[model samples]
Target chain A: MEGGVYLNLPKVAVLTMEGTNNEEEAFQSWRGAGANAEIIHIKKLENKIRKLEEFDAIFFPGGFSAGDYVRAGAIMASRLRATVMRDIENFVDAGKLIMGSCNGFQVLIELGLIPNIGGDYEREAALATNLSNRFEARTVYLKITNNTCPFLRKFRINQIIRLPIAHFEGRFIPANEDLLEEISNNNMIGLKYVDPYGKEVGYPWNPNGSVLNIAGVCSKSGNVLGLMPHPERVFNKYTQSDWPRGNEEDYGQLFFKGAVDYLNEKF
Target chain B: MKINIIVTLKDNVEDAEGQSVLKALHLLGYDEVSNVRTGKVYYIEMKGNDLSKGYEFCDKLLANPVINKCKVERDD
Candidate 1:
């Protein structure tokens, strides 16, 4: 369907930077979900060529930004914090939407967007190196833990979905035990790694050995979401690994669509 | 002055890289090696001799306080 067919379609900015790939698919996913999408370089925002305020939602695609120097997503997060932090804070305050996957998820954690327990954007969690000690590249099962998040409204609680995850540092580690409790109590965890049958069998099923089998998390407000899996890559059922095995679910498209629907109704 | 910052995962956190290195060392007949921890060192040159600046840099960028501990040292 043409975006022109929909009035006031949400404008999405797929934010990218050097070494940050996957913007192409992310843009396509947003457009497929009936949103106007554009791939914007970080430099554009830094140089004032384009402003975050112009977009209704922002998508941070996957890949190693700044070559993953210092840490995955650390460089990009620091640069954004140094330059457009105020704009981001304003965007969040305005109740807009934000989503990130894989390295993008790492950026959100580094920026302290998800699980911003202090409400000050102070870093409170880290996506540490995988306990497997190697880069895990495979499609895994995820159980939707919180359907209240805009990105997950199309899903149901305890619904199992399949998405591809590729990364070396995908483990979700909170700053402390109290923070972990807060994330759980607030229903900030959006997804959890699970088996094909929705069992929490550790290892290859969990992939990263993330705490509490967390595969994705959301901000306390449920507007911002970050996950280690690449939903954009699997927007089509044919792209899923088990599609040849008679899988017919296009699980990824719902993520973008849900957010777009929310943006249109709310913003 | 040159400031050096060493960033490593906190002691309580599981160090997968360190464990891998320890396993490799044990295989190479270095059984006496009890432990191995991994970290990154950044050497920065500054005109001003301010160790606090280095700490500030670490806090803002070089180190993520959630999983990392940064030690800043000044070399003149």
Candidate 2:
């Protein structure tokens, strides 16, 4: 239970494709937190399927892949479906951790990797263009939801974590009333927008019109996590815009730590 | 065959961009408008005999279930 005691630190593989650019940041975050991490290119994935079985966790990082053509993560998700999507499903089914951030989160939604907004297992939550219809780059406060998601187990409920979110399509929208209700009832609401004072407020603070200010969610088993924020960007103290006075010691780093801790416990 | 696809937010759903557009319209002296919502239109040309198949393509592939709803029309 000691901090950074990744005695069984899970081997993590970050999926990289033609345009994915955050794999290195993610690798560094995990590695700095004491987990073994590596970046695996999409072309090499076919030859590394067997090696994937040895890892305890896998991640998809953010980037403008394939020029975000045909919708943000559409092409990449389709490619994954063609290749190792089934393997990812198997890994999740086996109770291993799978994470997607930013564009990666979009891919998860597009591929039906994470549960959708409703419809039991296939509920599709909404991720769309920002209200401003332009790319937004800013640091936002997030209120972590009180959920049983393994990726967030170590964090306290309603914790106000400052993380930088840069994207054009981070708004989450649930398609219907039933879907919205299901997302609420199941505690699938993982992260929400909040004020710097730790209060759940509206607009600009939320940055996007995400329903209920949701910023992240996990699969029913809490093994699959998809988030719009970029924790990798904030792994280092110097990366934070308001480092010292904010007294914020890299909330993003804690995220990787939490994941590694979970893996160490399970493995 | 020519097909028209219309995409809109579900009813009662808030449209932030549309609201801003309405504000702009009001400022432009178009006071007759009471409400406004923004949507997308897609025109597609297909070389096929079956119209239903083309409609299916719009529903399954083009539009996403999360934020969009699409309607297909064929100009016969």
Candidate 3:
């Protein structure tokens, strides 16, 4: 490692499991943001081979985890809940960071980490199948709803950015109207799907038809973030689909860099 | 002992898969069908004949209360 600030870089774990194919991208993105990152399999945590306490941040990348058997992230979430539930709670209690994108976002909802209004990790939302009844794979414009989240601190509130989203079940449905209201009342929403003009729209614009056009959600404390877009997949300007048309923003790296910066300052 | 569990999506949630099937059925001239919803069934074999274990499985992993409701049946 280099001298100076690199001497105490934040450690990030890119958690993965069977069918989760994006760990490599997640690991590289974190490393690109000046963090010590490792791709750790979920089995390592389940078997007690790796400890969550060893890492400053955990990232669940996008993929069809556990084959998306019963649901997009049901099996993986259940497995994690069975083994590392308490450890995850302790990790959150310590004000550490956790970010999940795409299927990883579904896993966080399944694990009751995002929009955890009850504060007991109760499953309060489900990302059902898209209203189009088809798998959506495309670049989407997302308006940053809240920037207080550790993962979104680098972005300005209400700023619209483009990110790629690919998933079958990406619709965000809270348990009830009251819970949905509570999520908004608590400022847990992080991003909303928007048109190129930054207007909240439906169908092609909101890819999944998520209620309220919610594209991402954060926990009450803003340490945990779950979103359906794959920011890790587009760590550089060239990877973005429209970059060839004179676009030059490396938005993906900012999400990781923001979390790394937060970890460095707080821990 | 054998236990059977049927898990179904709650009424409030949109059943996209079921809706797709319904659309296909309508295209096939099955307009008589008004609604369609899909679900899953799981069969488990347990050494002990306690029905509570089946419910426990549903609570733990078989079904998520946020979107699904499960029914457990056991044969003793």
Whole-model lDDT, model 2? 0.78
The reply for model 1, stretches above 4 Å from the true place, is: A1-7
Q: What's the TM-score of every candidate structure?
A: 0.97, 0.83, 0.96
Query: What residue runs in model 2 are displaced by over 4 Å at the alpha carbon?
Result: A1-9, A46-54, A117-123, B1-48, B73-76
Candidate 1 vs. true structure, TM-score: 0.97
lDDT of 2 by residue, B1-76 (tens): 8887777766555677788889899999999988888877777787876767655654444556666666767776
Q: Which tens-of-lDDT digit does each residue in A30-123 have in candidate 1?
A: 9999898999999999999999999999999999999999999999999999999999999999999999999999999999898899999999
Instruction: Sort by DockQ, best first.
Output: 1, 3, 2
Q: Judged by DockQ cut-offs, is candidate 1 incorrect, acceptable, medium or high? A: high
Q: Which residue pairs collide in model 3, if any?
A: none
Better of 1 and 3 by lDDT: 1
CAPRI-wise, candidate 2 is: acceptable
Docking class of 3: medium
Instruction: List, residue by residue over B1-76, the lDDT tens digit for candidate 3.
Output: 9989999999988898999999999999999999999999998888987888888888888788888998899755
Judged by TM-score, which candidate is best?
1
Clashes of each: 0, 7, 0
- Residue A205, model 2: lDDT of 91
The number of the candidate with the highest DockQ is 1
True-structure Cα RMSD, model 1? 1.3
- Which whole-number lDDT from 0 to 100 does residue B62 have in model 2? 57
Q: Write the per-residue lDDT of candidate 3 for residues A1-267, one digit (tens) a residue.
A: 666766588989899889997899999999999898989998999889999999999998889998998788889999999999999999999999999999999999999998799998999999988999999999999999999998999999888899998999999999999999999998999999999889999999999889999999999999999999999999997899979896557989999989989998999
